[model samples]
Target: MTQTENSQFRIECDSMGEKQIPSNVYYGIQTLRAIENFQISGLKPLETYVDACIYIKKATAIVNGELDCITPETSKAIVEAADEILAGQLRDQFVVDVYQAGAGTSHHMNVNEVLANRALEILGDEKGNYKRVNPNDHVNYGQSTNDVIPTAIRIGGLLALSRTLHPALDNAIAVLETKADEFQNIIKSGRTHLQDAVPVRLGESFRAWAQILSEHQNRIYVASGDLMVLGLGGSAAGTGMNTHPKYRDRVVEVISELINCPLQPAPHLMAAMQSMAPFVNVSGSLRNLAQDLVKISHDLRLMDSGPKTGLKEIQLPPVQPGSSIMPGKYNPVMAEMTSMVCFQVMGYDSAIALAAQAGQLELNVMMPLIAYNLIHSIEILGNTVAALTDKCIQGITANQERCLEYAEGSLALVTALNNHIGYLNAAAVAKESLATGKSLRQIVLEKELMTEAQLAEVLNLEQMSAIRPLGS
Candidate 1:
């Protein structure tokens, strides 16, 4: 249809009043109100979240049909319409901003309206024909925005973690393990407080980082499991007044079968609806991932700082020209991007924490914001982890000669002379090395603190890197 043809509209009404809706679209009056009301964030709902909600509605319809709550034809239409949504069709029909009302009522209705109209179309009807396929009466059935929004958020979050975040993290771990093995022999000067401390294998640091990321992956998996305990059957205030007594368990079973996840009804409907701690827990795990990622990026930046002046221990692949005016200059662009993304994910975690705490008597009103922050944080961090692994970590090159040179020259090597020369004499040797610009071995030999053969044995690069290096 031409833009002018789509510009034609049909009338739709609700308790508030009536409005003209786009004649060619599936969404109806309430969704239109939401688009106008919550224009705060230009972001749309995550497609996974919208699909999760559709899955719930579809499961509800199937259960309702088996229970004789709705006719077989109505169930068939709703199921067919929802299947289209699950198949990734008409995804653009979800129009509410990620920033919306506390209960996410607008978004819940948005899904209902779209499904109702499309179901009508499947039954040989036109759009906005609510009398034949009502959004609230038929599409929403026994569900409320309070129950559906949070339930869908949990489902969507779990699906994304399983499909996107976990795999990316695994890829990162594998890449880091490869780098660790590749750099095992590259001994480098380890720094404490930005000052040289002692020798360490370059591969050891990468191995440590990989271990930290692996622990975070376990945390996210546990949190995602907590999300499986859902509050799907709890309508409005969680009293189970409008819904059939058996609807909750049956619908949960249907949904679990549909999504192939072991979803269960929350033990207490009111408590589950009011508390977002589960999501907060998941967000906290994501923040931990961001923390580790920030550390890794900073380490890369510091190690790759300068070819002439800085540590210059490793080289990150130059993905782009770093400076506009500096001739032939390259930057650690991936590390820089990773650091910025880490900061953003942490910020998102703060919003999720506060929103999780902002719930009141019966329902959390900040779900829209929470959903927005949670999904985006997971998605961006996953994408960054994959990018950092493939584009930077996998391709990094250790400056073995520079690392060995720095380790051999470091005044901290005087630590190896502690038993031979005594603490006081070893301190004197470190001071002499720094003062005279001579390597620790040269200073020790010149000061006659140890013989050349003793120095070689005590200050062996591999020996100094050990947890306990012999001094004598």
Candidate 2:
């Protein structure tokens, strides 16, 4: 309805009551109520999540127009509005907090209202003229929050992976692989339980991390398969209530073509709507990646610990001053930031796990929480990984002199003499070397453990650090 007493506000009526909505906004009464109620988190919905919802609305409108479920004009108007939104218009209309109503009804209505109002405007009608383009009747023809929210989550996850995470992982893997090849001949002391154990080619370390990231990318891809099976046609409670008989398959087909992804209807709409396993599985994969990233970040910090007093085996590119009081000091800020982002991702994964299992008989009230956490986790983790790659991994430079020194001075070098002098004798040589501050070669030659030629061949650092080709 148009504003009666004031020109700046319009009255929007709902079943509960009427509220005066700001005339300038696209969202309506329900969204306003949500804004008022859930001021808990000032955070807005993630952009990919909004895009997911808009895509769903567009697909539904297309199918409904074909089925004559809604008028052709109304469907056209809604689809056009959706297109405008997708083209980066009217984003601020999605104002409801991330912690809104259960099953994301508040946010769902927010989308419906915005599209409805915009469609109304497209048809030469006012924003609140539900009689012309009703939010519930025309815009949301055969859907309910129960089905739409979960399906949005699916689309959002897939979009995030394709647009954000997958590319980041690819870049990181490429950087690490390049580093592996560049550092292939640099040998360093390998540590087990933080003590020197053997020699390792530094390139092998980078190669292993590259392989880890590749595996994580593969796991995420595998987990995303479940997201393709959508609960969209479930409608109100998954009974296909009030939907056109052909709407299920047709809508999924339209959505698949629209998103350019191969999506299918769920075998059991109720099961798909009720279970949050797909999201949980994807989030779990993210957590797995995050854990590995933390380990890698810590390894970088340890390797680049100090310039004079610590390992100093490698140097990370200095992006910014590390300490205010200490000039000429640089820190592993990129790796540190990566670890921080990864820890947040793990936290989001935990919240997603709890929310997934919190669903009850018909629906889960925790969908909003899951939606925000899962999508945000994917985006932030992806961004962090990309930054780590560009800032730290690509710019790393090896300290060949320091690495060689550590490799040569390591007492574990005596490990190679076991076959020549026997275990007890090799152990005695190591003990004496430690006691007398002598080198392993010096002690071994003094004891006449083996001929110099034999000792030199056994203790060859390059041979000891030679990395066997994977799968060999």
On TM-score, the leading prediction is 2
Task: Give the Cα lDDT of each candidate.
Answer: 0.88, 0.94
- RMSD (Å) per prediction: 3.0, 1.0
Q: Please write out the lDDT profile of model 1 over residues 1-472, one tens digit for every residue.
A: 1123455888888899988887878898889998999898688889888878999999999988888777788888999999999998999899898888778898899999999999989999888877777889888888899899989888888777866788999999999999999998889998999999788999999989989999999988888888999898899988766888789999999989988998888999888888999989999999988998999899999999997888899999988998989988999999999999999999999999988888888888999888888888888898899899889998999999999988887788877789899999989878877788878788778878789999889988897885543874
Q: Over the full model, what C-alpha lDDT does candidate 1 score relative to the true structure?
A: 0.88
Per-candidate total of colliding backbone pairs: 1, 0
| Model 2, global lDDT | 0.94
Task: Put down candidate 2 lDDT per residue, 1-472, tens digits, no spaces.
Answer: 7686767899988989999998999999999999999999699999999999999999999999999999999999999999999999999999999988899999999999999999999999999989878889998999999999999999999999889899999999999999999999999999999999789999999999999999999999999999999999899889999899999999999999999999999999999999999999999999999999999999999999988898999999999998999999999999999999999999999999999999999888899999999999999988999999999999999999999999999999988888888999988988898899998888878878788899779999999999767997
Query: Model 1 Cα RMSD, Å?
Result: 3.0
* Candidate 2 error regions (>4 Å): 469-472
Pairs clashing in candidate 1? 102-365
Which candidate's lDDT is highest? 2
